[model samples]
Target: MGYLYIFGTILFTVYGQLILKWRIEKYGSLPPLVKDKILFLLQLLVDPLILSGFLSAFVASIFWMGAMTKFDISYAYPFMSLSFVLVFILSVFLFQEPVTLYKVIGLSFIVVGIMITSQSV
Candidate 1:
């Protein structure tokens, strides 16, 4: 069950990050609000991508809390680093981002780290 929770956390984290990227692309960055900031905020909130991302993030937060309750932080936190690899893959497929050798090497290291940490757990 702990492993399941960990996997769920990883999924939630990855999906949450992807959604955030979608939101950013759809809505762009939040500009400095000098005046009529409330209207700007409202406009930002009305964006579908932003709303979906926010919802996914909220769900991820809840799953993360559940995972934390089920496992030691030391064990669980390292697993979250899986997001680095996940984001890389997602970026390549979803956004047509380049996957270079350096990125592959970095992702390999991330996998190695996760393996080592899993051994400890």
Candidate 2:
């Protein structure tokens, strides 16, 4: 059940990251002018998808809180790295982002680290 909380955290974290990227891509590049930049960000803030992304962050935090109750932070925090591994894989496919060999290796290390740390508890 505690692992479920950690899973929930990973899923929500991935959703927030992907959603924000998708919505921002729709808006195109940031404006050069300072005033326009502020307005551009304000517009994104009001966007429903963007709002949901932000909300997902809040939800992830709640899940983290739940996870903390069930295990030592050292035992559980490593699981959060799954979010990065997932988001990295997901973005490459979902967003048509490039995948490099170095990135794959780096993420592989993170997964290995999680496996090692998961055994420490």
Candidate 3:
């Protein structure tokens, strides 16, 4: 059940990130002027998809709080790094983002770190 809470946090985190990126891409880049940029962001704020993204973040935080009660921070925080690995792979496929060797190496390290830390549990 504790692991489930952590998993929920990871899923919500990933969903929030991906949804925001997808929606923002559709909205295009920020405007050049400061006022225009403010207006542009305000436009996104009302978007249902963007709102959902924000909600997902809130949900993720709740899940993280639950996780906090279930395990030591040292034992659980490493799992959060999995979000980075997931987002990296996901962005490559969903956004056609490039996968550099350095990124692959970094992700490998994250996975290894998680594996090592999970042993403490």
Error of 1 at 85 (Å): 0.7
What's the ranking of the predictions by lDDT, best on top?
Answer: 3, 2, 1
- Against the correct fold, how does model 3 do in TM-score? 0.96
Model 1 pairs whose backbones collide = none
Model 2: per-residue lDDT, tens digit, 1-121? 9999999999999999999999999999999999999999999999999999999999999999999999999999998999898888898889888899999999999999999999944
TM-score of each: 0.79, 0.97, 0.96
Model 2 steric clash pairs? none
Judging by lDDT, tell me the better candidate of 2 and 3.
3
For candidate 3, write residues 1-121 as lDDT tens digits: 9999999999999999999999999989999999999999999999999999999999999999999999999999999999999999999999999999999998999999899989944
Q: How far is candidate 3 from the true structure (C-alpha RMSD, Å)?
A: 1.1
Question: How would you encode candidate 1's per-residue C-alpha lDDT over 19-96 as one tens digit per residue?
Answer: 767766775656687566666678877877767767767776777788888888887888888888988999899989
Each candidate structure's count of clashing pairs: 0, 0, 0
| Model 2, CA-based lDDT | 0.94
CA RMSD per model (angstroms)? 2.6, 0.9, 1.1
Off by over 4 Å in 3: none
Error of 3 at 102 (Å): 0.6
Candidate 3, residue 66: the lDDT equals 99
